[model samples]
Target: MKHYYGVKVANKIARVMVSSPERSGGQNQYIETPTIEKPSDERSAKLVDLILENITDTYTLESVAEYCMMSVRSFSRNFKSSNAISFNAWLINVRLNYSLELLESTSLTVSEISERAGFHSEQIYRKHFIKKYDIPPKAWQKIFKSPNHN
Candidate 1:
């Protein structure tokens, strides 16, 4: 059986766990992440909103840059600087979040959600979904029901 110790940080509970380590530290080391801070920009924020609103539509970085009235290079740099992620990554995250919301609020199948979430195929959705959530979409749905109340 696996054992866990709980720790509190910023009023949030987190579990310190021991498991089969993926690397040489043997499950003892805490994961490290770099802090890359980027101040938000209005143009990038507007572009993100547009992307989320039209997730089912096909739009490229160039198009989004045009929408923001800037050249693609400048838009890309500002987007990365403001969001710490690329435009495509932000689009994927928006689509994934939409899929997750549908899964939790509607009785949509994985394929239907994939279609509506702008994923080209169920396989693609499953791949990114697992990467983001650490579980298959169906497995997540099975473990949690669609909420019955608003």
Candidate 2:
């Protein structure tokens, strides 16, 4: 005999199965595994670290290449090859991620967070945030903020 059961908790369902006689080779075949890629090399890893450290600063491809002690052309080529994304895209992602953390952790307004995130203007920050998250930063903050407010 076999039995299957499902329980709902916190608006999500948890499923379980039980059998009088256990079957061999009954693995979770439906589970999905994610593939995580490592940094291609030391240079790419260092670049990522530096960017994260100075995520609030403005940067250009040429300036960043100079800081890395490489020619602009070589830096752009290797950055894309090693990171699997363009430099600008990586920088924007880093800034956005930092902004998200600030929004969730602090009570700062959206405009203040935008300035601290290295965006040139709040409008630009709002546009990018909406594009990436499909919701405004204010709304996102409301959803993620703690529930202890009066």
Candidate 3:
């Protein structure tokens, strides 16, 4: 019965080929998992470009709605419907992208980069950066900007 169940399970799943017969000897390679990115509609895509163009500018949900010439409630509803992310989340994503560029291209400290990228504080920026990138900003800078990197 044990051997029957093992055969049933083995036939039901994909197998990895390894040179060694030992089960533990198979090398595990890092594979990038697929991400389901939301496909923004035309209006939301344009708004993303506009927000990035003025990335350094301070923004509030109310102000963004006003800029879009829509009522705050309607703006929130429509933006989320089209973009599949809340306004605040998308805003943070934009800020993170700007900070990444700064980290790679400039010698600025993390605090300065956070402030220039419109994050509320360095700690918060690092928290979000780690959550999004699975690494700290300085470490990312070291890996990406180092001349000694192979």
Candidate 4:
């Protein structure tokens, strides 16, 4: 009887572990780390800082290139070389990470979160979030929200 109970408990534990998204190789695989390292060159470093500071604002490749005082083609090449990711890809990762933080920390609606996260529309935000998380924003919030301390 003791051995049977132990086996049953082990089976339950295995099921729980396998069902977890982290263990199942799910959405986490797509979400990149949000940190941006300073580039070796002063201009690229400045660009990285500017993007980090203005993550909640809309920006275009042209605008970013101008801000960095480089031609669009030059900026794109330099940025990709320094960051190992395309500028747009990095921007999307940053915005999605910010949205995830807001969702976990606040009770804001999805539209409000989308706006604050720099997405042009809630639909766009939802699309990206679903793509990266394998779940909708509300569902993610429900799963990860902090426990009430009260």
Residues 22-139 of candidate 3 have per-residue lDDT tens digits of: 1334343111111224445555566666776777777788888877778889989988886667898888876876786677667889999999988878999999988877889898
Instruction: Look at candidate 4 and tell me the lDDT of residue 52.
Output: 71
Index of the highest-lDDT prediction: 4
Write one digit per residue (lDDT tens) for candidate 1, span 51-110. Answer: 666788887888988988999999888887777678888778778767766766568899
TM-score for all models, in order of appearance: 0.68, 0.69, 0.64, 0.75
Q: Of the candidates shown, which would achieve the greatest TM-score relative to the real structure?
A: 4
Which ranges in model 3 have alpha carbons more than 4 Å from their true place? 1-47, 146-150
| Residue pairs in candidate 2 whose N, alpha carbon or C atoms collide under 3 angstroms | none
Between candidates 1 and 4, name the one with more favorable TM-score.
4
Order the numbered candidates by TM-score, best leading.
Answer: 4, 2, 1, 3
**After TM-score superposition, what is the CA distance of residue 117 in candidate 1 from its true location, in Å?**
1.3
Please give me the total number of clashing residue pairs in predicted model 3: 0
- The better-scoring model by TM-score among 2 and 3 is 2
Instruction: Count clashes in each candidate, considering only residues at least 3 apart in sequence or on different chains.
Output: 0, 0, 0, 0
For model 3, give the 10-residue run with minimal summed lDDT: 1-10
RMSD of each: 7.8, 11.4, 13.2, 9.0
